[model samples]
Target: MTTTSAFPAANRPVGQVIVRASHVELYRDGQEVLRDVDLEVAKGEILGIVGPNGGGKTSLLRLILGLDRPSSGEIELFGEPVSRFREWHRVGYIPQHAVAFDPNFPATVRETVLLGRVAPRGVFHWFRPEDFAVARSATELCGLSGLEGRRVGALSGGEKQRVFIAKAIASRPDLLVMDEPTAGVDPESERRFYDLLGRLKDELGLTVIFVSHDLGVVSARVDRVACLNRTLVYEGPPRALHDEALLRTLYGGGTVTIAHSEEEPHTHGH
Candidate 1:
């Protein structure tokens, strides 16, 4: 398979850099988690990041979201330094396993999604008519319109995931960052979710950055793929990642298979 161009000039404006990282490094407990990493995310692109567990995938995302600071090097969001960037509403994030919300929480689906609008509405302001409209539209877009009144705890794992996605989309963000959004979802549900994501990307012109251990899904769906293990080892089209030698190098050489089927292939390492 030939590698596809990640940044097609016809789809988006030229030289539109949404996220840029230069020589970024991070340390935790005196141990290096990321080393001299450099990355760029163009507008309207789906960038899939894959690597083994503890390979600093989440760490890199944290730096981008301003959740954590890099020990050295520079990072920028929308051309502004991350530390000074204040336009958080332009970015939406869904953490791994949708862990930000408690499964047993008593909030309804609509109410939970309404939380997303709070950022734009300010810290303590009440939800206005427009806020409710946006939340409802987002819920409908995520196929959760009928379930809006249901308690979040009563929903299944897949439904819960959709609720979170609706919450993210309610913000109307330009960049969407997801950390293992399909972690605990069933196979069928996961497939449906990815399909929805593809549609959403096209309809919203979203720039997505996602981290996943599922190589098959990453290869099939993303415009570009980056293999990170402390440092970036590969960064290009998914077709370029089919090499067995490269797979072994990324996963530490036990066994790796890239499935081209409709479903994601099973892999041993994270």
Candidate 2:
């Protein structure tokens, strides 16, 4: 039975945060994707964004990452306006479908993870001894220990994901944004990957916002579930939003059944 208490809760500031989007709008080549979307993610919480294809899930991630600006509305992260927080180092992102480069990229796993420490951020102006130490620590924490010398392309799906996570955490950001970290992996690998996230959030005190299509399993891992269909449909705890009617509405009429255990209360709605 998985519970929120299975992992240690973050001890950092779980203060009232305003990770809000005020009437946010996004356009791609004159076509509207996300229309007037409003959302918020509190501190010490894992917010899962689930939706069907082309539901603007990736676009929303881009907006929050400051990779792209909204056509309208404002985005605030951690009570501070995103635009004003020039410290991009405060955030980490594991992008969707991120795979290892050419098998001949000529970089070790440790070296690739160290790329997270490369210039321009406050985390490290240059690759210093402290940076190496931090990278080493992150690699170990992500369970990459002795495999640091392995070539990235040679690793399995789960191992590759862990390496990217290590790279992201090497920066030691306050917020970690992961987009579909478990996609395409085997079931065993997928479960292990999520277990790693659980450990990271608890031990490292990082705020996680991940996007996934595996609603059933993902719902069990997060503190809150936020359904988006070009805009916000529902946002609340797993139990509150894990109803068939709500999911059907969000997915636009699809059947979903969730199995529950007597030892662990599970909810499914669609």
Candidate 3:
């Protein structure tokens, strides 16, 4: 595939670099999972990080979220170094697994989303009226308005995913990070989920950084794609990822195939 500019000129300057990793290297159990990785996430863009299993995708996310420190190099969030950054509320994170609620858990949909406010509201403080209003607004935004009172445990997998997304956006975060968000959803649900993300980016001016293995979804939805396999193999627009040799290098020479779409000329790596 031919390389095109990663972002249009108009969208490029919506905000400063929200996340930056410079020469980052990570090691676990004497094994180097990531080496000399450098990445940047600007405002108002959906960046998809794609790679095979054990490609340090989740490790990179953990470092960005401050859950783990890199073995070397540096990271910055919102122009502030990671070590000194204290504005955790500006970020919203949705982990790989769904919220594990018991079948009889009494939390309602609104209540579940309200948990996101705890960080800003203080753990020991009581919820204020604005907190409830924010949670309700997020619930409605995620298409769960009618289900505000429904038990979270009784919802479908797709609905559960929305609930988590609502929770992440409840704080009106500037950046939203998701790991394998569509892992358990059906194809239709996945499509709708990506559509929702696009809407969120336009309406909320939110910057999204997500880790996904689904090449079709990445190609169709994300603004930029980064292929990682111990290192960043390719970092550019999704359409630029048309080289079969590059795909083989990223996927470790697996039997790769490209599926094309009829409606639009796009490639899906497999």
Cα lDDT computed for each candidate against the true fold = 0.85, 0.76, 0.83
lDDT winner among the candidates? 1
Kindly list the per-residue Cα lDDT of model 2 for residues 172-222, writing each as its tens digit. Answer: 877899888777566677777777888887998788899987676766778
With a 3 Å backbone cut-off (N, CA, C), the pairs that clash in candidate 2 are: 243-269, 243-270, 244-269, 244-270
Q: Candidate 1 residues 1-270, lDDT tens each? A: 112233221222246999999999999999999988878889888989999999999999999999999999989999999999999999999998684467678999989999889898888788899999999999988889799899998898888999988899899999999998878888887887888888788999989999998888788888888888888777777876687767777877877777777654545562
Clashing pairs in 3: none
lDDT-better candidate, 1 vs 3: 1
Per-residue alpha-carbon lDDT of candidate 3 for residues 94-143, written as tens digits (9 for 90 to 100): 99987444658788898899998989897789999999999988888888
Between 2 and 3, whose lDDT is larger? 3
Cα lDDT of candidate 2 equals: 0.76
TM-scores for all predictions = 0.92, 0.86, 0.89
RMSD of each: 4.1, 6.4, 4.0
TM-score pick, better of 2 and 3? 3
Stretch of 10 with least lDDT, candidate 2: 1-10
